[model samples]
Target: MTSYAFTFPGQGSQAVGMGKDLAAAYPEARAVFQEVDEALGQRLSAIMFEGPEDILRLTENAQPALMAVSLAIVRVLEARGLRVSGHAAYVAGHSLGEYSALAAAGAFTIADTARLLKTRGQAMQKAVPVGHGAMAALLGLDLAVASEVADAASQGEVCAVANDNAPGQVVVSGTVAAVERAVELAKAKGAKRALLLPVSAPFHCALMQPAADAMAQALAEIEMRAPLLPLVANVLAAPVSDPAEIRRLLVEQVTGVVRWTESVRWLTGPGGVTNLAELGTGKVLTGLAKRIDPQAIATAVSTPADIDAFVAQLGL
Candidate 1:
């Protein structure tokens, strides 16, 4: 029996025509898009299937749109008689993807998750002014070095580590000037690349505290049940099942570091997770899984063909 985990992707993984094929091939996927569209009071699926690029990439739209696709895949899987609780030992996701994981695990309904993510995206975007904040990726630098780079660059302006993505990949977020300074410092520190990201706001840093507060309020209004399976929370890099704690962590995740590298290590090491299924639009998490632990089998379940293959691999 193989121990399996299902992972979902976050922002930046959204594309122009995501989930079009699935919507065409599976009614489950179509209904998911419809449900999200109704929940958000917008036809986001059209934007997802035929995007104007900028509109679909808007944080509010992207967050829920991505979740819809992930949930669609989850529903399709369940329709195939392979449910997350039955097969997955745990569920994890990156940033906005965390809501998707919880939704899959039955902590929240699909419609509730969509509305929550929409609120989250709107709150996060509103937390910082457009030109005041930024995020940057510091490549070829480990977490310690990246932290140093962030610290040295912060001239008292809030530059801080955001995502510890992998062994040599870390993201820093803060004031634009501080992030720019961190890039230069990273270059000086021999980072292969230190480039500013095109994100709308600086996320996972103190600047996002306002957004965290907003999420705390929004999350309190929803009924959070314990997930069907535990979630490897982004902020803690550990599995957490308590609904109260999960709500708190979701709030903290707004302004806390995403311990992605450590989370993956914990899954492969102590959790003994051998298979990672990235069920979403892109191969982003699949790539991360391979980079983090090549020994584990990582599969991207996007297409109908992929769905069949994954089912076959599971001996269904």
Candidate 2:
């Protein structure tokens, strides 16, 4: 008798051997991994189970790898009699995690999502050359102040807010110079910490326009269906069910700020979701869920044990 919103982790949640255990424990999980491997025509599961660390961390691999783990967990949960249609109230994901959420809700198949994420990762990386772009985290600064700081620091470059993760954690992405300037301005504006992230591309900014264009073409060819459950889209921080709208939003998300704080607020506030089950590679979103809303019961279902326990708790 529990109603919860299912959330998926984004890029930074990846790790070595992310889905290895679940693959060993469940056939459905294993099948999901195999399908992704076939779709990408690469041994991505090997990288996920046994990584060279750096390769798996590549944006191209990381996007689908994270989604694969999430989809694997979703398949296992389905096998356990947990239907997203009737069991979960809504679904949301962080950045690339949105694809995983859509796949779980049947908006896209696992194979198609894998291919799209692979394309997305490659497009994003190709959009910006190495050392030309950067992203920085500005702690202890609200979105309004962060926006002001980014604008002031832009120096006529493409600097802008990329993610509003929480109340005071804002991330800015842009050319290296602009992001560096934003860091300095944020620190001077009384931020507790402002530091650059070790990311290859300045994602979710105007500079990613090329990637957005690529995704528009890529998404246009793919077949999208309405989700079984509504999705709290990143760009809107609101529920969307139309396939066409979701397609457009997915393209816009490439350069749009991820309104995660607002999305979580909608879930716990007006959406009335009490429990948050984060199904993915790491507990990154789980931690953020509590930070975003203390009263929400956030659980990470990343392992076979976690899935077993969660399914039982739900009376499945």
Candidate 3:
């Protein structure tokens, strides 16, 4: 028996027409899109399938859209007899993808997950004014060196490490000037490339505290159940199953470092997860998994063909 973990992609994985083919081929996939639209009381599916890139790229739309596609893929997989809880040892996701992971694991209803993400995206967007904050990726620098560079760049500002994505890849988030300073400092400190990201806001920093508070209130109102499988939370970089603990971590994750590199290590390390199935639109996480641990097998399932191939591999 193959021991695998299911992973989901986050924001940057979205693209126009992502799930259209899957929806065209599977009623289960179509229903996931329909439920998200109804929950949000708008045609998110249309926006996803027919994109006015500007509107669809809005944080509010992109967050739930990504989740919907992920859940759609999960529904199709389940319909094909590849239930995650039965087949995978653990489930994890990047940033907003964590919500997708929870929905796939039966911790929350599809409708609830959609609503939460909509609120989360809007709140996060509203947290910091545009042009006031920023995020940048420092390539060829380890997390410790990245942290040192961020600290040096802070200069009494809010520069902080946002993501430890993979080996020698760390992202920093802060005030625009501080992030720019960090970029130069990282380059000076021997970073191969330090470039500002095209993101709208500086996420996962003190600047996002307001968004974290909003998520606290929003998450408090939702009813959460223990996940069917353990979740490797981004903030903790460890497995967590308690509903209340998960709720708290979800809030903390707003302003906390997304320990993607550490989380992947924890999954493939002592967790003994040898295979990673990325159940989302893009192959972002699949690529990251290979870079994180070359020994682990990674695959992505998105379109109908990908789903069929994955199910065949499982002999289902």
lDDT of each: 0.94, 0.95, 0.93
Top candidate, metric lDDT: 2
Give the per-residue lDDT digits (tens) of candidate 3, residues 39-128: 999999999999988788899999999999999999888887887899999999999999999999999999999999999999999999
Q: Assess candidate 2 and give its TM-score to the true structure.
A: 0.99
Taking all chains together, each candidate's TM-score versus the true structure is 0.99, 0.99, 0.99
Model 3 spans with C-alpha error above 4 angstroms: none
Those runs of model 1 whose alpha carbons end farther than 4 Å from true positions after fitting are none
C-alpha RMSD in Å of predicted model 1 compared with the true structure: 0.7
Error of 1 at 71 (Å): 0.3
Local accuracy of candidate 2 as per-residue lDDT tens digits, 188-213: 99999999998889999999999999
